[model samples]
Target: MTLQEIFALSPIMLAFGVHAQLSKTTQNSTSNVKEEDVEVIRIVESRIQRLSSGATGLGLDSYETPQSVSIVEDDTIANYQLDDINSLFEHVTGINIDRTETDRTYFNSRGFDITSMHVDGSGVPFGDIFVGDMDTAIYERVEFIRGSNGLITGLGNPSGTVNYVRKRPENDFAARVDLTYGRWAKMRAVADVSTPLTESGTWAARAVVVHQDKESWLNLYGNNRNVVYGVVDGQISDTVTVTVGYSFHDNNAEGNTWGAVPQIYSDGTQADFPASTTTAMNWTYWDTLNRNAFAEVSWFINDDLNFTSKLNHINYEEQSELFYTYWNTGLDRQTGLGLLGYPGKFSAKDDTLIWDNTLQGNFNTWGREHTFIVGVSLADAQTSDLDSAAMSGFDVMPAFAGWTGNEVSRPEWAAPTEAGFADIKLNRYYTAMQLSVSDRLDLVLGGSFIDYDNEGEAWGASTSTTEDGTSPYLGFTWEAIDNVNFYASYSDIYQPQYYLNEDIEPLGSAYGRSYEAGVKSRFENNFLISLALFRTEQENLYEFLGYDDGDGVDDEDYSDDFTYALYQGITVASNGFEVEVSGPLNDEWSLIGGLTVLNMRGENGSEARTHIPRRTFKLLADYAPQWNEKLNAGVSVRWQSEVYSETTGFGRITQDSYGLVGGYASYTFNQQLSLHVNVDNILDETYLGSVRSEQTFAGSPTDYSVTLRWDF
Candidate 1:
């Protein structure tokens, strides 16, 4: 069918499906129905399932997984008013969000960076500058598996893996709309609708739309975002199902700062600046666009075996013009007049395709029941030539007097030039087996073989390389008692490097090992508690040496020419402990909380990883009065220990320990309408939100939002 015809027939299709379903329930009427229609009706009446797909790739319960797993469901998203995927990380245990750049965000897990991402168990390329801008409204839930996950991710950091499960079409008709208004002229609107598309109820469709426009606390900074997502699902037969989806997103921002305010002034004294201080120029801006499409097919051969396949395609583009102010020479403590600003333009386009196929089954071996899975994946990624340019002799800004938040005209420059291009392809084959040695004990074994080829050009130099290796994985679980379980797992993973080393050659990939052990407890399946200890070690780690050249000539610095170099052969280690509790405390009260203690250092026993905190805690609870079914209230608190920046000859800058408190309340006036009010940073604490070698970003202050939602 044509696109226009499909759009016009959607409502009619939904209404017909609902009417057909209702006709079957008439008591006095004898109407003959098709066999397939009967089956579809029965399936549509079943309750929703909340199993974790990313935990083990076996569709097992969270408690049954051998590793530490956390799930943030749809209810949690609405209760906390988490608008985007990045906001959800703040509440997860042992995970930290680092805003290193205006358009990029890094998720730090247990002192390691989370570089692997998946959608519905299908691996995809990472490192997108606009990944953090993804809206969570279209996702059913997010699943996180902590510790080594090489068995499935193939090539990635050992820290963890994140899976975003998109919402599927509903068997019955449902629709919802939300409108929100908040501080700093923030406005947001979201709409979601789902319904059956065929009379037999075998086909279903869902669509979601979102729009947001907001201004930040930083001087003259603002952003506008728009998103659209749609999906179609069909049960072709009793044992076959198919799904297809597409998503589009665009974000544009003006007056974005390339870096935060300077941390220290000349003379070695820390600089004190207002929270509204900004490093952005009036003409500086950043924009990004992303498009994605995916399809999946599942065949249930029998109760004992199943097969599935998934394919995905993605296209992303980003363009920006930024200005950076650097203190080339030591600033005079008294004058603060030693800073110089430079401007540059950058644009990049990326396209990727991924395909994954798998087969799993249950069988009996040696009189023991076991589960086995085999899978293969392929990925191809390509980037267009990067277009870039720089303007010399641009006027510099003086920081001694502070910023005035006034508009500044940009300087005219020369034409842009093509810098480089790159292409990467990866192939992986993996398998895993779960053996039930006895009723109370189980063992899991898995491994993957990866082959990679990369070709690129940099600084007019052509480069091509190929690498292949094997990653092994193992895990086991033992039921210590009826409601308690003990688990342990280990894996070997690697990370590919793209930068040239001190020898002016591309660095070899780094290798790492992860080990973890934990205890999990369940009380009546409604409450859960878990405690885990983990340690990780890596060799030949890559580290960025900054723009300064050892010689005193500023012109040779990497920052001036946009060239990057890396230092290798550095060893690093991290060990940490975590405790988490979630679910209902009772019929009236429900709570979710966690605590983490971490210690990370270099081989020489120095705290080289400064962005991660040594201690962190989070707590959120909700209460509903037995006498009032229409009202509910909740409160949350978060705390983090001191964190420092990378150490330099000038010393280190630290963000002191701090805490924030927030609360929310909701009232349901009727079955179809509700109102909610949320207040964040209720205590109005002032602290540093993020830090870099040269800049620091302040946390947000007290803010309030009101939302009205309607369902039909």
Candidate 2:
């Protein structure tokens, strides 16, 4: 059917009874009351089943057989008012979000970081903010599999996996548009449209675009993001389905306001300033880009037999331009500080391409039940960095001109003319599999092998690195009873830290391992509760205190030649327990909250980072009074616990780790339009969503926004 034909059949428009009203006035001789057909108003929400092609008992699960797994459905996505990819992560049962660096959000599961991300169970080349890329609008749901997805993810950190389930086309026409404006000129607009091209619903297509920009609450910094995406799905005969998709995202961040915590008073009191001051030093502009394209084909050999193939192509780039201004703890009449290090610039770029595929399925066997999945994959990940010396110098705390809010800082020195260059490449091939004995029992076994080559000129010297090794995996899961489940798994994982050494070549390592158990209750999919216990360990931890390269001359020149200072790195082991409950409390109220307590020991418990929070809590509550259905409003609040930062015995990065709350109210005017207003950090509390922990930066406050949406 054509678009116009579909529009004519819309139930929403028929409910107005306008056509019948005109007909009655023109030709009804029955002022005496005539029999008439009554139009029924019916609304059909998007079907949960139509959201994905298949299901594995729980919601949409990772078909590749995971050590332990879970899914976050689309309905959940809409429930939380999540606007971006990072926002949706809170839905994960055991995951925690941390801001370890500026704009670099770190998500951890089972005591380790999550470095792998997928698109419909396949890799998206550039997964996180590291590449300043991600546009979550095209996917229907996301599946997170903790522990060694190496069978499908190839080489990288094996701690956990994030798979963005891309949405395909159907015969029905669906479209939604949203526009929002936030504090400091933060504005965003997004549009999505999808439909089928063939009468039989054999061919379908979808397109999406998103644009957003916002001013920094930290003073001079501001950020902007743009995305464009498209996809095509075709049914090749009745047994095979083919899908191809492409996504592009560009992110530019200026006036980096890395946060800094004060050192005075132990209770933690935030001193107010002009807001533009970087605390001590925060002056840099960093930009990044990520582009991805992928193709997938699924074939059903019989009612119970199926095979799937996937190919992903990705391109990522990063750019940086910074000016450093030193802060001397000065009082502000102007920019508040003086210049120290010379104004300099540092830039790096990464290019990666991954080729992977999986052959997996389930076969009837055993008196009980059995399911198995296996796959093989490969990747070519490369990086290059270009740097420069001091170019200009200005007052670190210049005379004020209305603090732009962007942090400005200078570098202490520059790389020797020929040194500061890096070019490296790593190639890897991995094979893995998972087998489950029962609906509630699963076992995971996998392996990975990597070979890498790197060559670069950094610090006025040439260097090269060659390395190869294998990582193994093992895991098991069992449901203890009706409302409780327990799972324990282990996997040895690694990553290439590749970077320019004194010689300038890629040299890196990897780390990850976990023993986990969890209990989940899902009497109603809308109301989910879970508690997880995990023991995590990390290895290959490499930290360089920096060794002097022999460059002739005296002690000063003695620092020329890079000598050697290497210890396999510190090993950290952590035991933690987490509890969470989210979803509807009733028809008018819903909640999302969780808490985690961890006991971490690094370098065999010799020392603790003073500032890292050992315990953290996150809570969100939403209430919507029906008010007769047509009109409804919702209010939501969010909060977190005290967090820690490093201490130098002089000053510290303090994140008292307090609570933050935000509220949002939305109203539906009709079937096609809605308006929403949100005040994030309604208390306007001065706090950090995350911390980087240094004299350089910390995080800033809550902001507000309003959004309007139209759907058909």
Candidate 2 on 1-712: residue-level lDDT in tens?
A: 4222432464222111000011112213223333331101000111122222111111223222223455655544544456666666654545666653445676766555566666665453223334343556667777666544444444435456777777666457889998888778978898889886765455678898989887765655677889888887665544455667788888888765333322222223323343344432445667877778666665544433345555555666766655533233323333323323334455665555444444444455566434444444445445555656553443344443334433343545556233343444444454433455777776655666666555655454454567776666565556556644555545555565543343333345656665556666654545767666767676654434344544433352221223332223557777767777766788877766667676767775853433345666666566677766654444444444565554333244456656556566778889999888776556766654454333334334666778888999
Q: What is the Cα-based lDDT of residue 369 in candidate 2?
A: 35
TM-score of each: 0.91, 0.76
Task: Judging by TM-score against the true structure, name the best candidate.
Answer: 1
Candidate 1, after superposition: displacement of residue 418 in Å? 2.5
Query: How close to the true structure is residue 539 of candidate 1, measured as C-alpha lDDT?
Result: 77
Clashing pairs in 1: 266-331, 266-333
Worst 10 residues of 2 by lDDT: 37-46
lDDT of 1 by residue, 31-132 (tens): 254544544643343114323345556655667778878888888888788888777788787778776555567787888778777877766434423332
Error of 1 at 77 (Å): 0.9
Model 2 RMSD in angstroms:
11.5
CA-only RMSD, every prediction: 5.9, 11.5
